[model samples]
Target: MTDVTTPGTPVSAAQLEREADITRRVLESFDGCADPRLRQVLQSLVRHLHAFVREVRLTEREWDTGIEFLTRTGHITDERRQEFILLSDVLGASMQTVAVNNEAYGDATEATVFGPFFVENSPEIAQGGDLSFGAAGQPCWVEGTVTDTAGKPVPGARIEVWEADEDGFYDTQYGDERVAARAHLFTDAEGRYRFWGLTPTPYPIPHDGPVGGLLEATGRSPMRASHLHFMVSAPALRTLVTHIFVSGDELLDSDSVFGVRESLVKDFHEQPPGTPAPDGRDLGDRSWSRVRFDIVLAPGGS
Candidate 1:
């Protein structure tokens, strides 16, 4: 009988390959688990992640740095701030996702990212109430109607509106007392609604996290054009989350989130000073900026 001798602790190229194969096999074990959708998602993620590591020939130092960056991103988040959303904004992921899901349904209003600054449960204000909270900037009157695709008014739709101040900062960023710029309004029987607010001005997104680092590395500015954010919904129609951008904003072409759509841009015309108040409220000599937009909603099951 012949006896074969093996090293006391063998660590050959073949052994290394076997170890790597075992690790991959253990991870891939979940590929056939229950819930086909979960399996599909996880499998795809694993495949792509592994491919990325190989494609980039990623080093341990790079991986550690990435983990640290993500940790810091979480560290900077709070009730009024979200560094992760800012990261997605700088990467254009938010806009890309919105555009992908906002396909036209017979001229329905275009949808845009909701952004990270929206505060739930804003004060409800009657139509024509000044949303400006007395802040000074371009005087703008925003009026619009919620309508079905057939041009019929869809009354009783809820419209939640918010926008940056004249200087392009949100009320939350300023203080709770500045909540005047945010309001919720429901359309009347005529499907019409209006509000008074300052024309939005281009403002920079928060630039103090990983997102800021990315923007700086890419030579891209963090400014978003002046615009009003809207979230509108009706019982039988698709909810629309969008923005109305002031035409001719200097940063329109370079919006940090890539959210500027040509169709969403409208001119803010200056109404004559000393104009009579249609609602009989005392509006002083301030020049009012006016813009009118109509929303078309998709029919049920659309």
Candidate 2:
């Protein structure tokens, strides 16, 4: 008889014992993987995946459905949209990864999810310039300071800002506009930056696709709280990607992406009509809001 102990050879086992042996063999087969780190990660992933399958006693049909779902998610992803990222955000994986990667020391700004809406090569704008392109919403003045953890200013830090209008629709949502309500600016010598933006409002995640279907099936809401997104960067400091949520928004307690942190919540003071803006520009006769968000960055390579 052929040797049964050899790799790839048949072996006899009770049905209950087969799964355990298979797990062991699959892990052992990676012993010669050249990259040690890759081996370690793949081994761990295999263990967890196998454990999950066993715990759920996953059915064949369920497995096939999952494969098909992932296939569709990949198919829908393109330059302007990312369905896979939406799936990860809803599943909490994206936030968890951010938390693991960003452990700021002292009063450094906390990091949050880089949502699917971010676009590269945003138009550079001057301080206090309006970012909205006639989008519907009450204009708001946003001013902020950028500093190191030691409380020293970080001048010339690049600040990229973007947000949805009152209607909960981003400029990218409309095909006519290439860019709106999003721009980049640099901090002044005092580490201060300002811009005119819209008061963020609650909006639903794109729910016309597979990720949306998953949310609905799981009895989850897809509403994200009102918030302003920021990506601030400076020399010798870690780039910070985060958000400042509008205080008192109904969905703040239950942001669909779980991106909110207590430290990131901020109050937007409502100013009466004709209140002067931060850059000495007149607000005319319309009401506006003001918010101050100061950021502290951790040293680079931390």
Per-candidate TM vs. native? 0.86, 0.92
Residue 194 lDDT (model 2) = 88
Residue-level lDDT of model 2, residues 196-240, one tens digit each, is: 989888899888899999999999999998899999998889999
Best by lDDT: 2
Clashing pairs in 1: 139-289
| Model 1 agreement with the true structure over 85-191: per-residue lDDT tens digits | 88887788898888787778888888888899888898888888876666657667788899988888989898998888777678878646567678888898999
Clash pairs, model 2 backbone: none
Query: Residue 82 CA error for candidate 1 (Å)?
Result: 1.0
TM-score, prediction 1: 0.86
Range of the 10 consecutive residues with the lowest summed lDDT in candidate 2: 1-10
- Candidate 1, RMSD to the unseen true structure: 7.2
